[model samples]
Target: MNNNQNIAETAISCSGISKNYKKVEAVKDVSFEVSRGEIFGLIGPDGAGKTSLFRILTTLILADNGTATVNGFDVVKDYKKIRECVGYMPGRFSLYQDLTVEENLEFFATVFNTTIEENYELIKDIYVQIEPFKTRRAGKLSGGMKQKLALSCALIHKPTVLFLDEPTTGVDPVSRKEFWGMLKNLKKQGITILVSTPYMDEASLCDRIGLIQNGEFLKIDTPDNIISQFAENLWAAKSENMHTLLGDLRANEHIKSSFAFGDSIHITIAENYEVEKLIEELKQKGHKKISIKPIKPGIEDCFMELSQSA
Candidate 1:
């Protein structure tokens, strides 16, 4: 990856990236690439080492092994260069909580040796939303507003690539949706984004995603591709006694996998199931309101299956 690399080429690349914390392996030989200007997602649950990997890539910390490059600059030798070319939002809100929103934004801008006015266009859409409360202390902002202010500050210097670590972990549903929308808009402006999120649903919004688990990548592909590769027929199973139903479904000889999903259970059948016969069997076992129907696999389903296999 070099300056000549276009929007479609790789803007970020990591080869055998790994990090360890005493006894625990935080990242293990994780490798991937993010094309320039693409909204590439690193999807996994918390404590899966997402933050560790993000720290290494964003130059906040060094990996014990392997190499990575952001904007064609090495993570080690070109750390300073990488810092100047990328913007990072950590999992935690790290802004000056006591400072006014405007002050925080200005502080970040000055640290980068740039003025807010110099890159105002890059952050205008996001910043304008929070500008009305610019004089307010950042600690007093609502979750959504705080999220917006953080994003505005991240973009204050207009870096070529952005790294967001679990950006939507604790926000409200609407705010999460709004934040992702902002990322979509940023993509149109040709800024490559590497966003990590523990939310499975958000995985579909990325141009491509790398599914990680326990410090290792289980799979990497477009969401649709990952779902298409799901191994078995899936069914949504529900009954009055949903808890017991899960155990019963898992005990069934023909069932390959069974797990609770929301109010219903997602089941992967080992072979063709006779729906009517299965219902009759459950009824004989005293299950009422029993309903089972074939269901399409989503990112969560794919993740569950991969995790089990891994």
Candidate 2:
């Protein structure tokens, strides 16, 4: 088939992509594909090469090794076309700070050789949230409003593939939820979204996720699938003295791993170890109101396991 047919099958593809900053390797031979109109997330913390990969894919920077294609166009040779067809919102708010919200959106539309009237329906849901402040300067808007305005500017051009780098970092929890909702609606409109975020809770929001760390992807699969791969016997532990509980649990030979989760410590014990024995040991050590029980592993647990193994 032709390039258009190929483009219909995959929105983005990268093979052996690598980038380095002097002595540091930002990305290490990473490869992945995002299907058209799907929400594929790069789930990792800051400096895990999420931004580096995004820059390479968006053709803003060249990869030191390997190749990447966006909408079937080679990133290096077809950069101009890729730039025109893809929308990118970097980790920082990179819009014109001095310009009003309406002006910023109009400017992006003009740069893409399109008018707001042409693609207004595409960003109407998002723009309407910030339309009342259309005259306000972009820098003066609140965190949530700035996020919405940035999203509006990114979508003004009606790009085929949208790349968002840490879009919800500083926004309130409510805005973060609403931003993901907007993404779901955009997916319905046949726009492919590749978003990066450090929030583990947001992993479940995507169709699939790649667990990245230190510039490498430890695992890539649907959230459920990855969690299913966690075969260890996980348990949650809590005591009146939360601070001392972690050290005591790790000091025990039966405990294989222990990490503090919200309001408790999650641990994986030695195979065939009895939970009662561990509770008794804690009780002897003066840990009052001790609570220990089996628990299912989440994305964070899986990441810790994978990182340890790697």
Candidate 3:
């Protein structure tokens, strides 16, 4: 039998979860289950109900309807148990800025009625990296270091389920890489991790991801599976006049969708449209140094296709 299978099933579960603020629907009919020891990502841009859903799961707020559970403890009825067993690191820096690195960890440990010594092994890898700056106030640390401290505190209690919301939002490339590495290590200890991020590149790091936008889940699967299901003929088109080229492509009758992607524009064509003809149209429009090629779809491309279809 699989070790993961022998462990607890359904680390987190939500059914028809919904929340609203006046006329705005933050989350609608959301339902999903995260298996024990799995790293699940809620991938979406800001204001995409990631935070709203995180709040409901962490017991920081309530959902207007529906039910959710963390580690089989109801989020509403058993909010206290959920809090005790879960570690939540919100998107914003909620740690005490005035406190030194060591102080923040101690404070959270005490708040949870445990000493840092109790779970020192759980956070040793993360804490050792920031130990040299133990006396520095959290506000004085760099963005990357601050995140590390926040993570250290979150793990001090050795919670079974971890919820990290956009932990790498403003972090640097190297720190982002380091942070994901840390999450990988934590999973080895059989801790269930649910993380949210806006970076499409980070989506591939998760065991599974849920694509959320406009308060709804667009798709949920392994990153490879999502991209494999991108049923579109995507092309990368670029020219010296990228700005004008974007306008030209969007106005074309054969294009289903077109958007600027860094140095080039990614386009989805109406079914059965040939790429050669699209290149010819751009050339006829006086597009110089124009280049177009059929390309493999990444997660961003998949999200675009799904978002448009939805």
Candidate 4:
């Protein structure tokens, strides 16, 4: 491993972390670390144990096996200290619905034994966007505004580490972009952030990402590194008949895997197969006006490869 790959003084650390409910395991032997001041993302689809791991790290729930720590404080024994040093914004908006935005902020600050003015600078940038609606009830704000408010409240305590559980899940595209910008600003202020999201596009925004599925972490690395590790030659093929193109590609013996992307089907061809041979085969399958070219592997592509191999 390179120097950069070596784990630094981690803001959060977990080893052999496992959790379960009844007969099902929510997280299985998951282990990874987030370096200080870095934005580490947990990328996976729903029911992939992202929230379960978040709950354990935030001290909201206990892990059934292994151990974890935040800022060198054990999550179980030092729950209070860990809670004080980290801000957790759950996937759902859990702020008081009846309280105004300002009121909600004040309440959270008070709970931390601090005042809004004391931590005002920490959240000033985000708060400014929602300041105009300070008097609006939390329940009345739009999805974007509510997200900002929730984030502001979480930062009111000036936590050293921030845990955002799918913070942009339901927000609009513009708001999702805005929220990531806010996280970048927070990173500049030296706050280590651990955010979970199902969006593969957002994976590139993080310094490093842990791709989790079926309650286990499959791989962890920088987005570019992960994409480079995709060993197969990938191609994006499109035809006039999109549906038939997918079925035809799948039926081809030379094709390893084929899945529909936005405007094309991302395909991995078998080893030792020339592009010309594959094109000829597709053409014989009645895929006229076909376009096939090798394309760069994206985060989603890497993710699909990992899941398929697993």
Candidate 1 ranges beyond 4 A from true positions: 1-8
Q: Which ten residues in a row have the lowest lDDT in candidate 1?
A: 1-10
Instruction: State each candidate's clash count.
Output: 0, 0, 0, 0
Q: lDDT tens string, model 1, 1-310?
A: 3543543367899999889999999899989999888899999988889999889988889999999998878999999988987899998998999999999999999999999999999899899999999999999999888988999888988888999998898877888898999999999978899999988999999999999999999999999999999988898999999988987887788878888999999987756667677788889889999999999999999999999899
Whichever of 2 and 3 has more TM-score, that candidate is 2
Q: Give the per-residue lDDT digits (tens) of candidate 3, residues 1-310.
A: 2533543589999999999999999999999999988999999998789999999999989999999998888999999988988999999998999999999999999999999999999999999999999999999999888898999999998888999999999877888999999999999999999999999989999999999999999999999999989887788999999989999998999998898888889988887787889888889999999888889889998888888889
Regions more than 4 Å wrong, model 2: 1-6
Off by over 4 Å in 3: 1-7
- Pitting candidate 3 against candidate 4, the one with the higher TM-score is 4
State each model's CA lDDT, in order: 0.90, 0.92, 0.92, 0.92
Candidates in order, TM-scores: namely: 0.95, 0.97, 0.94, 0.96
Tell me the tens digit of each residue's lDDT in model 2 across 1-310: 1433556578999999999999999999999999998899999888899999999999989999999999989999999989988999999998999999999999999998999999999999999999999999999999898888899889988888999999999777888999999999999988899999999889999999999998899999999999999979899999999999999998999999999999999999898788999999999999999899888899989988998998
The residue-by-residue lDDT of candidate 4 on 108-195, one tens digit each, is 9999999999989999999999999999999999999999999999999988889999998977778799899999999998889999
